[model samples]
Target: MSDLVDKAKNFVAEKIANIKKPEATVTDVDFKNLSRDSVTFNAKVSVSNPYSTSIPICEISYTLKSATRMIASGTIPDPGSLPGNVTTVLDVPVKTPYTILVSLARDIGADWDIDYELDLGFTFDLPIIGDITLPLSTKGEIKLPTISDFF
Candidate 1:
């Protein structure tokens, strides 16, 4: 009897391990808007859902770093849902104050751009599998806003 129960547990574990999970990629990160006090950037995330229904996004947590300094970190709660069987592109807004940008002046002065590392956590509510968090990261340089952008 004990052996049968152990076998059943192993089978269940194998099935769960073989489940097809969603996949995601960070396509781009670009400047969006500039305010008097802060600048906003949009991180474009493309998620491919394998299931046949929409899955709710529990949260999107992110950290933006530049020159070894953390410029911004926060969580976006209940952003929305990922439609099943389709790849959806989501825009995540990351805002940084002028004060923080000033801290990265040395790096910016070198090339007129900011070298950044963005780490993103996409949490989704998956049926039977409970909640799962998919992590994605990207490193790139973003050009600073030019004088023409203000006009």
Candidate 2:
């Protein structure tokens, strides 16, 4: 009886390990718009689903940081669903207030850009696997618009 139980455990473990899962990647981040109080940026995420049925996205949460300081963070509820057996791209919007940007003037002043790290979480429900969270992170510098660009 003990041998049979051990064999069953090994089989189940192997099956779980061999199962294929969906993959996601952050493609790009771009400036979207500038308002009186805040500047908005959009991060593009591409997810490839291998299943035959579409997976519903519970939420897309994001946090944008600069120099170890959190500049912006928010959650997009009920964003949408990922198409089955296809790569789907979604946009996550992040807004930073002018006051927060001003505090990072030292970094921006040096290179006319801001170094940032973006963390994103994608929550989805699989067929029988229950809930799964795909976390992605990227770091880069964003060039701030010059005075001439505003003109």
Candidate 3:
């Protein structure tokens, strides 16, 4: 009986390790030139699951923090499943020196972290059974040219 329990625990851990977390990034940051009342910036986040089993429904958290304060935070309901990938867009006011943090719980013991780049781009690879890091880099943040003059 004890051996069976240990085996079960190991199995569960292996599965949990296989679950992949979504990669959150700012795909596009468009600064609209208007009255400057409140400029809306659009950002995109992508999530992918590579496990054979379907991921359970859970809440996804996205947070944008600056050096001194948190710029924005939001949550979205995700019924994530295996071999599943999704992209979500968010609109936020303009703020400088911001970092985005995206996280989600895969299961009771499994969770995910968003990989980011210095240029405001990122990619996430799902965990698999044998290979810890999957070769797939399905999601990527596209860069847009910076506009010097916005009149």
Candidate 4:
């Protein structure tokens, strides 16, 4: 039983480490003259999981911070089960460059490090029969147009 938990945790950690960060390339930036509003475009993040296991639910979180200030944050479901490759679009108003951190948490239970005594919910009839947490994390960047560059 303990072994199973360790295996699950390792699996999740590896998967999270391998999960690719969202790639963003400015496809188009439209700034109207004399207007502060600008339309910034970038590709949505795409995450792929090759594990042949069923997860009750998968949640992905995105946090963006700039100059020690949190600018924006959001979360979306992993769309690997869908038909397409699962792309999420983010249309952010460029105020300044920011650092983006993306993390994934799932109910797979294969990668969770759970203390059997403390975690009552996961102790009974464990699906994977192991104490494991499958949370993973990665990060990327979004370059905001400088004030002078916008003009």
lDDT of 1 by residue, 82-143 (tens): 88799999999999999999888888888889999999999999988899999999999999
Query: Tens digit of lDDT per residue, candidate 3, span 40-93?
Result: 334443434433444443443444432323445454454243345444443333
Instruction: Write down the TM-score of every candidate.
Output: 0.96, 0.91, 0.39, 0.30
Q: In what order do the candidates fall by TM-score, top score first?
A: 1, 2, 3, 4
Off by over 4 Å in 3: 32-37, 49-60, 76-151
Which stretch of 10 consecutive residues in model 3 shows the poorest summed lDDT? 100-109
**lDDT accuracy of residue 20 in candidate 3:** 53
Q: What's the lDDT of the predicted structure labeled candidate 1?
A: 0.93
Ranked by lDDT, the better of candidates 1 and 4 is 1
lDDT of 4 by residue, 18-56 (tens): 753322222333322333342222333232323334322
**TM-score for model 1?**
0.96
In model 4, which residue pairs have backbone atoms overlapping below 3 Å?
Answer: 5-131, 8-110, 8-111, 111-132, 111-133, 112-132, 112-133, 113-133
Which of the numbered candidates is closest to the native, going by highest TM-score? Answer: 1
Better of 2 and 3 by TM-score: 2
lDDT of each: 0.93, 0.90, 0.37, 0.33
